[model samples]
Target: MGLVERTSSRCAGRAKAFKSPGAWHAAGFLAEADLSANAIERARRAAPAYIDLTSSNPTHQGLIFPVEMLRAAAEPYWFARRYEPDARGLLAAREAISRYYSGRTPALLVPPDQIVITASTSEAYGLLFTLLADPGDNFLAPNVAYPLFEHLAAAHHVTLRSYQLDESCGWQIDEATLLRAADARTRGVLIVSPHNPTGMIVQQPIAALERLGLPVICDEVFAEFTYRAPHTPPLAALHPALPVFTLNGISKMFALPDLKLGWIAMNVPAASAFGARLEILNDIYLGANSLTQAMLPALFEHGLAFTAAMRQRIRASLDAALAVLKGCPALQVRPPDGGYYLFPRVMCQDDEEALVLKLLERGVLVHPGFFYGCEDGTHIMISCLSAPEVLVRGLELIVETLTT
Candidate 1:
């Protein structure tokens, strides 16, 4: 069966268990076999070390932020420490985030009161899931998407309906498939602009989304890294009538994932109605640390230049990798509209698992498309976040193996 069918079957099974009082357990924690990871680990113990082309961690990719600047940003927090906490995060942090949104291309005015801070985007997802969905309610997500949504949904006892993203049409949302997937139980629609792995941005207007009348949860972590598109308009800015919750953080923006700070900016007057309940939920955990909240304003003040430099470096690496990969006749690659990942279709007849293993044997590691729910065709995901030389070398190895 396909990814959507499999997901539906699994969700149906999970929902049935929810009806029984004795069936309560950590079902989401169940692990499945990952053949590619096992093979890669085995390969690592042998002669040649594998060059990872799937590294997304900015710190590991030599994209470190200035330590002195970080220290200076947090210096004031050290001297004037207080334990006062607000459920919607610090006012200064929220105001800074408001300013950040207001300064975007088609500026969005997100009031500080409409923003709720979380420890990270993942945590924000968890909170939103709880806020929007009940035990058996569902949400719509793209078929070719990062697997985190599945896990988060499973954890909250919620189902995620799959919607197709047409690769032939530049990975745009298949509106028919999307509409068909939603039923009475679907509480929200999850949209990832500059989507992970595939890097397809939702540039067109979302008229189909308006018809559903459900809330929109947009992930914009890579909003600053658009390539073909001049800028990624915040989904909130595109449709003011639709209730949209925009999620972003400094992790991808400023290359500071370790700092662990993210937020949800609620748009539209209707979305703001949930702010009180959201505040109550946030107050329960108070997941965001006070120190990071204190440091946020300074980071925003001094980090724009750093983010611009990082975007340029990523663009250079992407261009170089694409130029080399396109030379290999066995691979059909397309330039992403944004972000630093290249999802190339493998024209070779080899099975996806076998192809990945073959690449690993030749000292390069990459992810198969199936890992990200791309079951329509055989594809591989490559990250261009590495240094230009390292990325080019890895791409050359992949090309050599596939062509041979």
Candidate 2:
């Protein structure tokens, strides 16, 4: 027999009689699995119909793109002529990234040496998680942050503890709460600026959080798209005194998630030991794509115009969505300072999953607030990057449902 089979056979006797409930094993261990499987099966069988507000992809959501620009983006690189970046990514690509950042915040002064491009922000997270914490060490995250980090943290064996982001103040992380969350085991803090789902910049609080003696992993993928305030300086610029691993990618910046281009720029004080250790970790992985790195110089120079126009289109859609949502008094939107999303709390005691299922039944796909680690109440996250007509129609339907 296989190891599992043999172990199961050996443990089948009378141990349960002597064991505490927690210490019970063998067939009883398998009993929990059986019960869980049955519960999941029953829930699936009993699922309610719904219109989902969970769609995020602009491409799939019927947004128009410059077809010619897209066609050109796919013209394959001359692989024979292309090769790996110098372990730190190509200098030209880094220069292009520097130019991109410099154009927005001249005061930020992003150095080419500080940037290490990855294929996606997810990879950047994996890299930074491994760099900042040993297995079993902790990173503090915003309570209602994106849920992807749970899987990312698991892969690196890093524990993530949630700190409340005050929803009363449009869901910005309260500085005091963050400071309380930090301890000797806390190696880093991850904040999503123009945060995912909630879409608000933690402007005033970011500085205070930085004062705590831990590295910061700021995900600013949505920096280019904001609905309020003159765009705050990217967090990389905000705290050069502390170690900051700032991540952004072509996915959100250029609306080019297909290109698989993301990067992490190390903005820690150059003298810090963390800075040296991260470089060694980056050198070991060398995870960047060379051809995409090669594409950066021309894309940043030319693509900035495309991105600027896209930003305008998204803002128009955001305005349209807010207006529609405002008409529905039962649903209140949390105004976003920057980002391609909005979080709207609706008048429903029913869990977000139930509400999302209700919407999905109406042929709308939306993300429920609970999906974003929200525990307190029901909410829905809708993408502002959708085509304007769909945004309008979706909100009308939402209003109709809320009123009736």
Candidate 3:
């Protein structure tokens, strides 16, 4: 049997065996492998310290939070503690998000009613997958995207098809690859501006996708952290006629991942049809807590200083990493336009996973290319979100491994 058939049969067997509560796992995503973490844990127990090049959490990387401001923002929720759940979200929070979008180019005037708040962008993806597709319908995404999409689609019983991102063209969307991947069962197309790992801003062919009549789901969580070029413009602004759902959150935007808040800015004529149904979906879990919703306005306004500091830190880290890697001839590094990752192609004969394990043994932890669905060659992604000293040390170890 083919992959789909095999996966379906396996899912059927699993469903029968467990009296299947949800069968979300049997949807045939990658196994929940913790091999990288396992390797890192073993190395750490045996050694004094390991320079983790895969560090993406901003809070752990030494970002100072405005504790007073954040505390004050959430204080109001406690004063008026009552369950006033609006299936869409608190209007005030949505209004705050709308105001945030009002500052975008072309002035994306997203009404508070059009916004659907969720616990995280990952939740937003689940909502969208269910809203746009029936089971067995698929969405096309970039081959080099973050792995979360695979899990999200699998959870919703949706298949994810990956189109190519032309690495030769600064990882722009490969239209031919995309066209070949889609069919009548394709429900939507997912794009990530300042894409994770590769940090490539999507210059989507809006006119072509408009013809395909598929809604465009653009994840712009890292839209603000540009170095080589201007920040990526809102994908919704570029193509107003096309059905667009722009996903962003306080996670990457304000370095507040633990805040657990995200929203979808809907910008299309057909969005109205989705509103009531989307509200029903949001109501099912009501995953977003009112405390963060209460804090969002102040967080958005006051968190600028924190985000500014982080952007500076990431840029500096990238420059420092590039400077060190310049001396290492075996690895090729392309500085990303945005995002906190540096994915470098490694010149090594060993399998990527084995190389990752070897690097772990050498007291540095980094992600192998295959971890992010990279099949082109031996590549590994390191985070530029680490502290400068830690990042420099990690890169030095990586260089030693590559050259030796």
Which candidate leads in TM-score? 1
CA error at residue 378 for candidate 2, angstroms:
1.7
* Per-model RMSD to reference: 3.9, 7.7, 5.3
Reference-based TM-score, model 2: 0.84
- Per-model CA lDDT versus the true structure: 0.84, 0.70, 0.79
Model 1: per-residue Cα lDDT over 1-404, one tens digit each: 22221332111232223332345452334333121324434454563777888778899989998888899999999888989999999999999999999999789999999999999998999999999889889999998887678778877879888899999988889999989999989999999998887888887777789888788999999999988788889988887888889999989999999999999999955356678888999999999999999999999999888999999999888889889987999888888989889999998555776787788889888877776778876899898998789899999999888887
The list of candidate 2 runs beyond 4 A from truth reads 1-52, 62-84, 205-207, 268-272
For candidate 3, give the lDDT of residue 122.
88
Better-scoring candidate (lDDT), 1 or 3: 1
Supply candidate 2's per-residue lDDT for 351. 63
lDDT of 3 by residue, 249-288 (tens): 9888888889899998898554765777888989999999
Residue runs of model 1 more than 4 Å from their true location after superposition: 1-28, 31-48
TM-scores of the candidates are 0.92, 0.84, 0.89
Which candidate gets the maximum lDDT versus the true structure?
Answer: 1
Which residue window of length 10 is worst by lDDT in model 1? 2-11
